[model samples]
Each structure stands twice: as C-alpha cells, then as structure tokens.
Target: MATHLITGASSGIGAAVTRRLHTRGDTLWLLARNAGRARELAAEYPGAHTLVGDLADPGRLSWAFGHQSPPQELDSLLHIAGVVELGPIGDLTPKIWNEQLAANLVGPAELTRLLLPQLRLARGHVVFVNSGAGLNAHAQWGAYAASKHGLKALADSLRWEEKPNGLRVTTVYPGRTATPMQEKVHRQEGKEYDPALWIDPESVAQTILLTLDLPRDAEIQDVTVRPGS
Candidate 1:
C-alpha cells in the first residue's frame, strides 16, 4: 500500500480524499487544525493516522510531522488546506492579506520543503488543491485570489525544480467547490449558499485519485475542474 500525507484532512476536500484513501487501504497521515475532528477520523478508521495542528504555525507543522516517523517513504503529499478572505482591493488589510497568504501559500510551501527529502526518496507525487481564483482574479476576492495566484506560481516552480528528481507536482484548480469554505464565500458575496451551483468535493477528490493512479512514467501536471452549467 502507498503512504500519503494529506493536509486539511478534517473537512471538505481533504476529508473526502482521506476517506477515499482509507477505503483503498493506503497509509494516511491526516493533518488539520481541528484536533478533535482529526481524532474522530482516526477513530473511524483504525488504520488512519492524525496530526492535529495549525499549518499557519511552522513549529506546529514541523512537530506534527516529526512525531510521525513513517517506516516507508511517502508516495504522495496532498496540500489541500487553504484559506479565503474576500474584500475589495481598497478594503484589504495587511493582516488579512498576510494571513491568507500564509495559509494558502507560505505554509504549504514550507511543509513541502520539509518533506522534499522523503518525497524524493519515494519519487512521490505532490498535489496542490488550488482554485479558479488562482487563474483569474475577481473584484471582491483580492486577498484570496492573490494568495491562490501565489500558490499556483509556487506549484509551477516546484514542478520544474523537482522534475529531475522524479517527484511530480500537480496543481488542481477546482472552481467553486461545495464546502464550508464556499459557504463562507457565498455569505461574503451576499448570495445564497447553493450546493448545486458548485462542484462536489468528492468529485475533486476522485480527480486527485485519478492523477495519483496514473502510470509511474506519466504525470498530470495541472488539472482544472468546474461545475457543469
């Protein structure tokens, strides 16, 4: 069985992906800020592992991964955790912008950097669960858009840098997924939270699974998933 580490594993796409991996009998290290929820996942799946800590804190992230010394190298690392802060460009505050960037970009970058050696040893795949905002900026979503844009750039750079090492980097741009985060976005936009209008998190998870299941010699570098209109 392949070994994998998944961030944002307590809920949303991360949780969906965790369940899929668990059902497949893969070794999973679930990381999320919700300690109790992470434990809940662990309890539900006796073989699943949980790391409860905030990715925004480097110390916490380091400690979480350090404590879990995997007997085998990782086959995949999925960075599905993200933050969204919506506001017009003029209304965006430094704190809000920085925090979004930290959660969406910097934190993932650091965690990936720390795990590079293990990933390289296994020639593993790295998947970044990005958003449509990373491809196109919107008026009231300055902070979130900018952070996702940075994340896209980081993914592209990592892909290029790690190609020689046989480590695959994939950026998945999912458009308006149906999740708690999307509910927050809908509220911020003063619109109704309609799950039907968005893509299912499980669909996104399946796409990720497809990417991971590709032949060892082939890789899906980038993927964009959107709702059917």
Candidate 2:
C-alpha cells in the first residue's frame, strides 16, 4: 500500500481526501492543528496516524513528525493546509500578509524541502491544494490571492526542478467549494452560503485520487475543478 501525509487533515477537502485514502487502504499521516479532531480521525481509520501541530510553525511540524516515527519514504505528500484572509489591499495589515504567506506558501515549501529526501527515494508525488484565487485575484482578496498566486508559482517551479529526480507535482485549482472556509468567505462577502453553487470537496478529493492512481510513467501536472453553476 502507498503511504501519504496530508496537511489540514481535520476538515474540508483535506478530511475528505484522508477518508478516500484510508478507504483505499493507504497508510496515512494526518497533520492538523486540531489535536482533538486529528485524534478522532486516527481512531476512525486503522492505518491513519496523527501529527498535531500548526502548519505555520516549522519547529512544531518537525517535532510532530518525529513523534510519529514515520517511515523513511512516502508515496505522496499533500499540502492542503492554508489560511485565507480576505481584505482590500489598503485594509491589509503587515500581520495579515505575513500570516497568510507563512501558512499558504512558506510553510508548505519548507515542509516539502524537509521531505525531499524521502520523496526522492520513493520518486513520489506532491499535490498542492490551491484555489481559483491562485489563478486570478479578486477585489477584497488581495492578501489571500497573492499568497495563492505565490503557491501556484511554487508548484510550477517544483515541477520543473524535480523532473530529473522523477518527482511529480500537481497543483489543484478548485473554485469555491462547500467547506467551513467557504462559509467564512460567504460571511465576509455578506452573501448567503449555498452548497449547490459550490463544488463538492469529495469531488475534488476523487480527482486527487485519480491522479495518484495514474500509471507510474504518466502524471497529471495540474487540475482545475469548478462548480457547474
């Protein structure tokens, strides 16, 4: 069975993907800031383990990994943890910009770097759970959009640079989805949250599974999913 580690594993797309992987009998290492939720997930899935730490904290992340005593190699690393701070460019404070960048870009990049040795040994795949914002920015979403755009760039650079090492990188740009994060977005926008108007997190998770299950010689470099509505 393939082994994988997923960030933001306690909810939304991350939780959905974790369930899908667990159902497929894959060994999973779940990392989330919610220790209680992570423990709940671990109890539900036989091969699932928990790493409780904030994604933005490098030292905590490293310590969490060490506590679990994970295997030397992993078949996949899914960077699904991110923060969304929506505000106008003028309204954005340095603190908001720094927090968004730390969680959405820098933290994931550093974590990936830490796992590069294991990934190289396994010739594994890396998936970045980006957003439509990663493709284009919107008003009142300057900070979040910029961070996502940076994420997109990170994925592009990683894909090109890791080619010789047989590493695959896939960036999934999903449009608005029905999740707690989306609810927050809806609140921020003063609009009603409609699940029907958004893509299902399970659908996105399934696409990720499909990419992972592709033949070793072939790779899906990028994916974009959106609601029909």
Candidate 1 residue lDDT tens string, 1-229: 8999998876899889988999889998877577677778788778887666677775567777676654357899999988887888899889998889888888898888888988999999999999999999979978888889999999999999999999998999999899999999889899999898889999999999999999988889999999988
Query: Mind sharing the TM-score for model 1?
Result: 0.94
- Candidate 2: segments with Cα more than 4 A from true spot: 34-37, 63-68
TM-scores of all candidate predictions against the true structure: 0.94, 0.94
Error of 2 at 14 (Å): 0.9
Considering summed lDDT, which 10 consecutive residues are worst modelled in model 1? Answer: 63-72
Worst 10 residues of 2 by lDDT: 52-61
Clashes of each: 0, 0
What's the C-alpha lDDT at position 148 in model 2? 92
Off by over 4 Å in 1: 63-72
With candidate 1 superimposed using the best TM-score fit, by how many Å does residue 8's alpha carbon deviate from the native?
Answer: 1.3
